[model samples]
Target: MSHTLLSSPLQGFTDFKFRNAFNHFFGGIDTFYAPYIRLNGKMVIKNSYKRDIALENNTELEVIPQIITNDVDEFLFVSKYIRELGYKELNWNLGCPYPMVTKRGMGSGLIHDSKKIDSILHRVHNESDVLVSMKMRMGYENPEEILDTLPILDKYPLKNIAIHARIGKQLYKGGTDLGAFQKCLDNTKHKMYYNGDITSVAAFKELQERFPSIDHWMIGRGLIADPFLPSMIKNNTTEYPKNKIDIFSEFHDRIFKEYDAALSGPTPIRMKMLGFWEYFSQSFENPQKTYKKIKKAKSVKNYTIAVREILKEAKR
Candidate 1:
C-alpha cells in the first residue's frame, strides 16, 4: 500500500521558509501543516501568520492552515479568513504540551474537556463551511482521555484526526505508547494519522509494520533533525545520497540566508538558528559538539565560520 507523509508544524520552526527549503531539497512530504495560529483573545490574524500561509508564499506546496483555540468565535474567524484565502481545510491543534498554552485550557489541555471540545466543534461545524481536521495528544493527564473525546468527535464531519501517541505531560520525553495508539484505532470511526518519534527509515518501517491500516504519517522534529528522512522513507532506502553533506549544506544555507535577511538583527537570527541546531545537530557526527559549535557563535561572522567548519568536517 502507498503512504502519505506530512510535515507536522513546530511553533518556532517549520514556517514558510523552512517548508519551502525542505520541499526543495528533500522532496517527500505530501503536505505540510503550518504552525497553529493563536488568536490570544483577539480576532485579528497576526501579520506573521498571514505571511506564513499566504498563497504566494506557499504556491509550490500543499499547505494546511491550523488554529490553536478553544473559543468558537476564534475558530470561525480563522476559518473565514483562510477560506477567503482559498483554503478548504483548517487543522485544529490540540497536541501542544507547553505549560503556558496547556494551563490556559488549550492545546493538550483541551483534550480532557469533552464538553468544551464538543461545544467548539459544534459551533464551528454549524456556522462554517470550511473542513476541520485535528491534531491531538492522547490526553493531558493520561492516555484514556482521548477515548472519551473520540466519541464526541465522531458526531462531526471532521476531515481526520492525527494523533501523537504520548500524553501531554510527557512533553516529548518518553516512548510513544503503541498500545495506547492501538486503542485509539479501535475506537475512532474517523481516519487516523500517526505522529511522534518517527526519526529514521528504520523507525518508520517499524511503525508501518505495526499499523498496517494507517496510511498517513506526520513527521515533526524528525523532519527538522534530518530533512532527508521523508524522501528516504518514501524510497525505502537507508543510504544517504553520495553528496549528502553538499545537499545538507545547501539546505542549511538557504534557510539561514532567508531567515537572516528577514530577521532584524544578529541576535534574533542567531537565537533562531540555534533553536534549529538543537535538532540539526543530530544529523552530524557529534551531536553535542555540533550544537556547542553553533551555540557559541555570538556574532554573525563567527556563526558563518562555525557552520562552514562543521559542514566541512562533515564532508570528510
Candidate 2:
C-alpha cells in the first residue's frame, strides 16, 4: 500500500526537481508540500516561487503548494490562483521561526496574536471553499504558547494542523519536546499531523508507540538527510532498500543536471549544489571529506570530479 507518512518541504532543499527525483527513485513520500511561496506583498507571483512548485513538468507526483502570507486578501488571491492550477488543498505556513518573517507578525509570530490569527482564519475559512491547512510551531518565543493559541487555531476549523513540536525560539535546535506535543493533543480539537525529528526507523517506531492515534506524520530535514527514511518509517524496519547509495546518488545527479539546465549562471548553480551538500553529505560514509571537497571545489569540472570520487568510495 502507498504510504502517506512522507517527505515535507524543506524550502531550498525540496524544490520540484528534488521532489520529482526523490519520488521516482528513492520511493517514500506519497504527497509533498513544497516550500512556502513567499509573495513579496505584491499582486503577482514571483518567477522563482512559480518555478518552485508549478503544476507543469512535475505532474509525476502529488505536490501541494504552500503559501506564507499575513494579509488575507493576498492569501486569498494566491490560494485561489493555485486552486485554479488544479490544487485541491492549500497549506499556510505559520511555523517558520526566522526572524525576518516572524518580525512581520507572520509565520510563528502570528501565533502570538490570537485575535489577529482568528480574524485571518475566520475570513479564510468562511471565504474559501478549497480546503485550507496550517503548519505551525508551539509559539514564537515559548514552548507553552500552544497551550492557549491552539484554541484560537481550533476556532478556524482548518482541514488539519501540522505542529513542528518546537517553539520559534528553538529554531530547530534541542529536542522536539514530546511533552509539549502531548499537551497539544490534549488541548486541540483539530486533526493534528506530527512533524519533527522522525528521522530513522527506530525513531519513527518510538514516535508511533508514543502516539498510536496519530496517523499523519510530516518529514522535512529527515527526508533530505536520508531519502529512505519515509519508506523505513512505513515498513517499521531498520533495513533500507538495497543499493540505496547508488540510487540516491543518481537521483542527486539528475537533480543537479536539471538545476544546471534551469539555473541562469554558475554562481546560482554552485549555490544550489551547496545547499544540497548540506544534507546530502550526511548520507555518505565519508561525509566530512565529501562535503569539504565539494564545498572547496573551484569550478564545475572539479566539483564533478569530487562527486565521482565519493561515488567510487561509496560503491566499495
| Alpha-carbon shift of residue 3 in model 1 (angstroms) | 0.3
Candidate lDDT scores, in order, read: 0.96, 0.83
Where does candidate 2 stray beyond 4 Å? 1-3
Best by TM-score: 1
Model 1, 146-193: lDDT tens digits are 999999999999999999999999999989999999999999899999
- Please report how far candidate 1 places residue 124 from its true position, in Å: 0.9
TM-scores for all candidates? 0.99, 0.95
Per-residue lDDT for 13 in model 1?
A: 98
Looking at model 2, residue 107 earns an lDDT score of 89
Q: In each prediction, how many residue pairs overlap at the backbone (N, C-alpha, C within less than 3 A)? A: 0, 0
Candidate 2 lDDT for residue 243: 84
* Residue 103 CA displacement from its true place in model 2, Å: 1.4
Residues forming the 10-long window of minimal summed lDDT in candidate 2: 1-10
lDDT by residue (99-147, candidate 2, tens digit) is 9999998889888788877777788878877688889998988878777
In terms of lDDT, model 1 sits at 0.96
